[model samples]
Target: MQQLTIVTPQPERPKRRLPKWLKRPLPSTEMAFTSNVIEDLNLETVCESAKCPNRTECWAQKTATFMILGNVCTRPCGFCSVPKGKTGEILIDEPERVAEAAARLGLKYVVITCVTRDDLPDGGAEHFYECVQAVRAKTGADVEVLTSDFRGNRAAISRVVEARPDVFNHNVESVPRLYSRVRRNAIYQRSLDLLKQVKDEAPDMPTKSGLMLGLGETFDEVLDVAADLRAVGCDMLTMGQYLQPSADQLPVERFVPPEEFDELGEQCRKLGFSMVASGPFVRSSYHAGEMAAEATS
Candidate 1:
């Protein structure tokens, strides 16, 4: 039997202190409706659950991607802070609540994602579709489904794509060689195939993917990923530095400077992506709609 190394590396301390410009103010803008929407819907969000640094900024703007299915994911990925094991049963009414939240928040766009439901036969694809439909029905906003591989279920993937969300997103997270270290039970080629399938299946709806750098990935690998994404017809690309949210999560390899991020943006543009969100703090859904709109224009 092959012995799994399972080396739990210590979280690397931030190389430098936060510059004044990098410091973010606390979130004082409370949207009571936002709280009510999430509470009423009983949805789990990476913002609140994973302790994303931008949760305050995103929520203060009255925007949040509704995490459906359940908060608990089936896979215990090395880099993720989301708790693992024992994902609860699918919530039938969660879709309605997400729609109600989007409608109540007056959101012009809604981004939805979920934990990987490996136990489910369809890998929660139908559930993602139902939520997108409900959000559209209730809010009438352009929807973005930031999804998983649906465990490579083509029919399940089609069900979500056929729902026709304005944007379809599936993040590759990192380069192929880092797959075992970054994502558990997720194949790099399979993920690329998912993006390819989205491009083939839903040509009109913009397809997007993202990767987190500073995970020991090289400049060449980053460019290679950009080429691969463009090859799969991914319309938008986001590259950001990996910030370890917790002690147990993956550590940052090296702090990438903002200039390097800018360079990456230029490389992404050269690789055929019209839109590239590349920065130390930029995330896939941060200003997603506005950034995506630029690509179409």
Candidate 2:
């Protein structure tokens, strides 16, 4: 006797939907004012460039992280949407413009960040120093600079540290296992080294770093990163869910629940981080002024 068996194949599961926690109202009137001010000054903001979900909220609050060294980034990090390759000529007057924009906005705490200019000799560290200086001189406000790894050049890191910004930030971005896929051009240890160097050079000046979740990292891995950050003397930490900037970017593996962010924040505090911002929409510079005040308070 012969028996024939036919097995039915299982159907594919559908992709996860955009969680309710991730949705928010569109920009308000205040956002228009901020947009006009930035546009009038011919400035670039990471809010718009990176398609940050919190843009409306941040802009309405009249705060935005100024993106210097032009809108184009040299690195092609899979999680970022900032334009990459052939960024054209550098804007020498950018520092002054940033200061002016901050002054116009009447900001008390100004945060400045830049594209990764690997093509440049100093990795744009000098320019970052100049921008921080200009912001301080013009507005007399507390300044924070979120910079690149400077290709692991101690001299370059020293250049920015010499400016003595109120806060020095360089995001580690992801865990070691995901570094290759999420941040192909950056090394995890090198980033940790950058934060450690900042602490060693200027112990009083707060050092900060950020990470994006939902990029296929495990819960234990996130805790490991928090421990590593603490080991390096990082004063502040920001953890947010990774939102895909575009169709071409890496897909989100899971939408970390808001409750999870609360738990992570507690864990970060346990690790001795003076300040921690963790949520679905928290970015490196989101509510940065408040974070700075909280950390120093």
Candidate 3:
């Protein structure tokens, strides 16, 4: 097998200007009905916390991916915008509130994700289990969980798996060589192990993972990561451009062209991912419901 070469990014790489393809129109109905529901229920969403480019479009469509375990994250990754430091106390009623918001949104496929809560003993795994259970009990909708690595705690990972979300997602984020800079506290192998555990615990459950491009990763590196995921029985994959959330975060290494995304998608398909979502605006939770449906189909 040929070794995939790692591209060493320069210490002071010039910021890549945003291209026209990345431009999105302002939200016409900024505070749509879904926004009101989430505000009323006092629920947090990754779409807002991560400052996802598709938030306006998803919100207008009255669909959202819920973010539990508080707004602040314990781990400070360079590529993420979620706030760092002490996240304060965990909200006990958060699970119920999340269920309420899902009910209000009338979502048939509910997606739940959380910040890395290294402050907690179980890494907030029990809270994730509770949220999945609450959503299922309330709406009887199919649930999908995009979770942290649980700090490689198999017991914590098992706790969430016991809840049995319809789809299990753990994003690899970037290539292994870029893990140190892009994902500070996260281990690339640990993420792969997390996804494998899902398949191990419940073979029938569809497992999913995501990758973000334009972080100075070579195409061979991206394909190698995809191959790694498929080897572990990962059923679905999402590949998208990594947009730097703020000036304080990691700057964008480059803006991947749309045509390149299509080429990547074709490569992923050949690698045996049951469903692949690849493009500039494709986030892990963007069109999550459709992704699950497609994966199962």
Q: Which ten residues in a row have the lowest lDDT in candidate 2?
A: 10-19
The TM-score between candidate 1 and the true structure equals 0.92
Tell me which of candidates 1 and 2 scores higher on TM-score: 2
lDDT of 2 by residue, 219-276 (tens): 8899999999999999999999998888768889999999999998998899999999
Estimated TM-score for each candidate: 0.92, 0.93, 0.93
Candidate 3's displacement at residue 279, Å, is 0.5
List residue ranges in candidate 3 displaced over 4 A: 1-15, 27-30
What would the per-residue lDDT of candidate 1 be over residues 7-44, giving only the tens digit for each residue? 89987665545544346678788756576777876778
What TM-score does model 2 achieve against the real structure?
A: 0.93
Q: How much is 296 displaced in model 1, in angstroms?
A: 1.5
